[model samples]
Target: MQTSSQLKRLGLFDARVPRYTSYPTAPHFKPGIGAELLPDWIRAIPENEAVSLYVHIPFCRRLCWFCACRTQGTATAEPVAAYLDSLKQELATIKGLLAPGIKIEHLHWGGGTPTLLQPDMITDLTHSILNAVPLADAAQFSVEIDPSEIDEARLDALAAAGMNRASIGVQDFDPMIQEVIGRPQSYEITKQAVDGLRARGINSLNMDILYGLPHQNTARIIDSVEKLISLGPDRVALFGYAHVPWVARRQTLIPTEALPSAEERLGLYYTARDLFLAAGYDEIGIDHFALPSDGLAKAHKAGTMKRNFQGYTEDVSKVMIGVGASSIARYPQGYAQNEPATSKYQAAARDGRLAGAKGHVFTDEDIARGRVIEELLCYFRVDFSKLADELSRPIEYFFTMVDGLELAMPGTTDLSGTVLSIRPEARPVARMIARHFDDYEMNESGHSQAV
Candidate 1:
């Protein structure tokens, strides 16, 4: 029922908005907050508190046309090996500032293709990290897997290093679409990867699929989702493809004429959403799905799910430390990111310093507004009164934009008493509504489409 008319009325074509994965999104980060702040943020963590670690492996064998991530391609191991050594240096620097006996509750390895690491490299990297900040007994380690780049040895190594959760990227199963996007992975290849990970005793698995591809239609999306379901992944992420060629240069290779219209994209999403719901997958936030037994689903029901640079996560650690090139870390004080380029990151690490390049320092108001935005993103509703009590501010202080949003998009938002909720029909544009409260100036032109 999300037709073109409905889309235009809702500004589905409105210039994109920040995904609100982090308050004062990365685009708003400034150079004034840089490397110097890193050690202090790390040292400020309360002693013995569990923290989350995100290590970025920014090397890939092939550059997919649709990826917007910060990654570089390498033909040989020289560059990847060099990057890992730099990472080791960065880890050591962080280790020096960390409180004695500090433990990690969550550890994540994100692409470009973490499996690109050789088995021995994985073991060495694991040891270096564990030696630095050791994992808590029940800490969870997760990695993003590329079906084409991973195999038995890598899986065995990851298993040995304590990777309990694996997120596999599928994008789509249509060979034509895969060809156009420059990422071709057959169903058999994906199954083998899953089989390999499962055989290694990795119990949690997440598979990613995309809608709004060049030629994706209801049939194509349904077929892809069905294939994904057959894999029996515990969690599935159905993402709307954002064609931001201006930001993601590789996306320029995808012909604009081949992209689905906003309305068609909506249709593809709803088609897949229906199938996932029918398969007993509970919808988690806008783009993720999880089985009833999945922790994500449980977190949402318990009103504790949170948004991060990695999209929605059940990991609620107040401090998340990001290592390696281009990774972002979240601190109670603010956010810090390492250098985006491999060479620069290596230089800083080799010099025995944090590779932080840019960051955002939160103001009291930024933090309050961030709380409201986060609650709405996770629960689709916010209790203004509760937020006020938590922040010790007036109710109006927390919702300065609700009235304006209600006026601008009538019937799209509800403000009765102290509870703010997007109407049921307006759930898709919740992120757009959430943006109204962002006091930080943003140029929406640079963001991705809301749908």
Candidate 2:
């Protein structure tokens, strides 16, 4: 690994960069690419193609202070039921635009807590989704489950609906850290949820844990990672906590003084990373780890892993349709996002109109640069010869883009012939290195720490 002084000189300690889940991140999406253009994007998909679908449930029983996702707290089921109706309506509207024989290869239900849905709601939503577009053979359906909010009935409903994968959020096992983050979930409850899922034969489990939190230390993270490993997750996402109080107002509740410095944050990540490696987990991308038998590890080995809004994925579908308030969809043409406000999204959906509110249309340059960025992030290297051939461009086209990359971060990169690789020691600054190819100007405050 690069020494602290060398890394600091390269701006690893004080740089803010995008996770690059998308080519031009969400902030770059603008208005005017809304409801009117969304239908065309949907209709353009070829008949009989398999695609991915993402459903957003933006309601939570209690909002965690560390989350920046668009969500609201609701004490009653009335709002949730109404939102369910909107989702069904939106799905039906999309069905009208889809060509014949289209099937969903991947279906993911994400935050605020998809498990918040009652048993009947879960079944109803699943049925509605299938009615619109059936699941493809061997389709993978996953849901983000909150341990504090799940039970047997919900699990039974999910299993009955063909959910084969489950992702649980275990931010940290330490009680003090949980309290400071306002997400009070106990390890016992988490284990119970995991056990229930395994009991129902949903063994493909994914767990997410945060590294940088208020008052987090190497010892605390070590304990948390050990407890997480005890649960036997198939995959784990070790994310660095992004504290953007200016954007996520609830983050203001956290004590800024208690947060770790950039250097300490890096140490926390490496500590957890070493533990996962010691436990026989193969590192996936920059922040994920998976057991040898897991699909992610297989994808990594086979060079088929991809990064999307949900982070690293093995799904290779060219189209991903997002349904619900604040959801974003990716099409071959570009990206489209739904109305962020629930009220507005619900009104549009009920009226049988697409709820798209903002997005970006991909330019030729956008697609080329996007591929370079994605390849570098996923493999820590870019195969210029292959990209040039795939993109129908000359090799010199890519060579020009790397003109100053190595000079900017000396001794961290190697450009030999047609490939550019980031040195293993400099992988910690991979995001910053990838930024060398980003053509869009950024608002530093909009991103998280580079480390």
Error of 1 at 317 (Å): 0.4
Q: List TM-scores for all candidates, in order.
A: 0.96, 0.96
Model 1 lDDT tens row, 1-451: 3456775666654546678899888888898576988889898888888999999998899999999888889889988888889989989989999887689999999989899999999999999999999999889899999999987888889999999999999999999999999999999999999988888788799999998899888888889999999999999988888888888999989998999888787788889999999999999887899998999999999988999988888999999999998899999999998889888989999999899999998888888989988998888899999988998888877666564565545567777788888777777877777777776643353222232
User: How high is the lDDT of residue 312 in model 2?
Assistant: 96
Clashing residue pairs in candidate 1 (N, C-alpha, C atoms within 3 angstroms) = none
Badly placed stretches (over 4 Å) of model 1 are 1-3, 13-15, 442-451
Weakest ten-residue segment in model 1 by summed lDDT: 442-451
Displacement of residue 60 (Cα, Å) in model 1 is 0.7
Q: Model 1, residue 333: displacement in angstroms?
A: 0.6
lDDT of 2 by residue, 53-84 (tens): 99999999999999989999999999999999
lDDT for 422 in candidate 2 is: 89
Candidate 2 runs further than 4 Å off: 5-15, 442-451
